[model samples]
Target: MKIKICFLLLLFAFSNSFGQQNNFNYKREIIGTNDQWHKLELPNEIFGKISPNLNDIRIIGISEQNDTLEAPYIIHSTEDQIKNVNVDFKLLNQSRDKNGYYFTFKVPTSNSINQIQLNFEQENFDWKTTLEGSQDQQNWYTLVEDYRILSINNAHTNYQFSKLNFPNANYGFYRIGIKSGEKPKLESAALFLKEIVKGKSRNYQIKKINTIENKKRKQTELDIDLGSPVLINNLKVNILESFDYYRPVHIQYVTDSTKTELGWKYNYQTLASGTLNSIEKNEFKFSNTVAQHVKIIIKNSDNEALTISNVEIGGSVYELLVRFSKPAKYFLYYGNTNARRPNYDISRFSDNIPKSITTLALGDEKIITKSETPKSEPLFADEKWLWAVMALIILILGGFTLKMIKKTDEREV
Candidate 1:
């Protein structure tokens, strides 16, 4: 009884310590123009103000028919009469009972050229609209030619089309004639516009760029051109083997003082890939190789000089020296022949102290020899829960036998 009581207590203690608790928080930030919203941070805080001398105003990403824009920013025009207006939004509310949003703008003239760019993912059904140029808001023209699809990745898509172009006028008011049709389950969408000027320079530049996905369906596009491309001197390391098919979890490189790590550029195939460069105050060098850990550090970009170390790759028994990040231990192994079921399955083995650390002076097995110290799992496998249950049963049987003998003695007395 005492032994069982102690066993129950031990189990209870282990169970209590096994589970985990939660402590987490979240935040987001967004920045961009009215039509070209970029860097959308999550948990968007909506705004409700407009510029006074408004030439145009475009709103993006709304769900309902009304102007309930829960996005990060709000857009409105101050002028009594608005001209060119464009709204790129996904139809979040479906069915014929509801409408999307109405985009309003005032233009100086009628029958002017207008362009619309909408970024969105495709739905099961296709969405079509007619481009209409109007001054009195009654008669409309089908100016838009057709729709074209742009793929970013497997997950997203973009649609683009020319709205209307006026050969005579310098500016005009335009709106998309919403025909009665089935709306797509709304995804992310944005608007685009073009203004007419005689001698303005088209050399506008992008300050920052970020990618959402890495596929072809809706590949992220960033426009950047300030000056010449910044020169980031680098030593390129290519894993000839494709990562999609097989990934090497263990890679070590040596950088004492000469080399710098430009981080990994993952490729599904061929040479097309991205690049990660050294960050600040980091150096790399090649040196005496006796350590057992590898780290890939992205040095801050503001540094003058940085070094990278040995690069080693491991799959199984396949550790090959290439470069270094720091002191590291690497091991790889593979099968050789068709012998009796192999005793050492490299896949299932990891030594607390790496076997390479222990070397024989002549022919003497070191104190840390693998043959003497059995592999970790095997040493304790045979005597797991089964053996513990067996020991408990034996102890209980012995105690019962002792009790029976004491009872017999008492009855005789």
Candidate 2:
């Protein structure tokens, strides 16, 4: 019975240890009074410690009755709100003059539009364009003048910048003129009004940048360190060269590293990729990623390497929209690898949430140490049990020896 009890205790100890392994490692107090809902902006310091998907984040509240309650939350990333409206237009005329080519379009409802995207079948071209709007085709008013449209298609880079943006203009007729020696093959065009509502963002300071030119590979590589891991989505590369150039660039981040004989070898994953061109703003936006070390590779091919003047990295702020039931003290816990992402009804009904919410501040971070489990006593610790087992074995051997002696004596008689 004692041995059985000891075995059960050992099993219980192992189960408790496994449970504690999944417990949160860190927590912070949510400092605010009772409210229906509250917003909390996540601090940058916690990005490195928490899970990349933020699945382990939990808002736990303790009530006056000593009851623990979990508050459901939704992670929100502040980003641009864009609304686009496509305007219907019919091609009125397409003609070519000695200087260039012209295409005219007529809007039926005379809706206002501020942007036009032009697509072409040509592999490469560099041309200037002029846009004019008018209610009567005979009398045209110039809206945009001497705008450049560029496209480059080669072994190294494939890029195009053919979008025309201007102030909203309402007209019955719109005309586009391309300054080209030969006829231009126009594939399609789109006219639309784009409304964008920019959101708040925070810029991360880059601590150091190291540039290296790989002459053998014909590439320029930049190693960037942001001091600490941060959630970033946007990056801008400023070039110092004045001449026109287009190059394919790839952005990557370090995911892990290993120690080799010479130094630490890093494994990187691509975050974003696009063409770095002089015609457009060299800005690239991608999904939010948590990273500390980033690498940029520019394919220069046979051309001279372009000088980089500055690099800017930033992202939208992450906020938690939490709903509270009653007045209670709440704490945020995170840093658990075993935790899965939570699903709550509030996520489905996010539209019902109030537009305005009171933001709450967070207290100092505290480390949550796991509770120690009780140690079970050893099964063979008592000397009495060892002696008892030894005496029982001796008694069985002695009985067998006496029975064999009696059998031998009976056979001799």
Among the numbered candidates, top TM-score falls to 2
Clashing pairs in 2: none
| Residue lDDT tens for model 2, 7-95 | 45865674555464338888888997568988999999999999898998988876776655778999999977779999999988899
**Model 2 error, position 57 (Å):** 0.2
Model 1 ranges with Cα > 4 A deviation: 1-113, 119-129, 149-173, 177-181, 184-413
Instruction: State the C-alpha lDDT per candidate.
Output: 0.28, 0.87
- Residue range with the least summed lDDT across 10 consecutive positions in model 1: 20-29
Best by lDDT: 2
lDDT of 1: 0.28
lDDT of 1 by residue, 90-159 (tens): 3322224334222333455332344554333443333444454555556655455233222222222221
Steric clash count of candidate 1: 66
TM-score of 1: 0.20
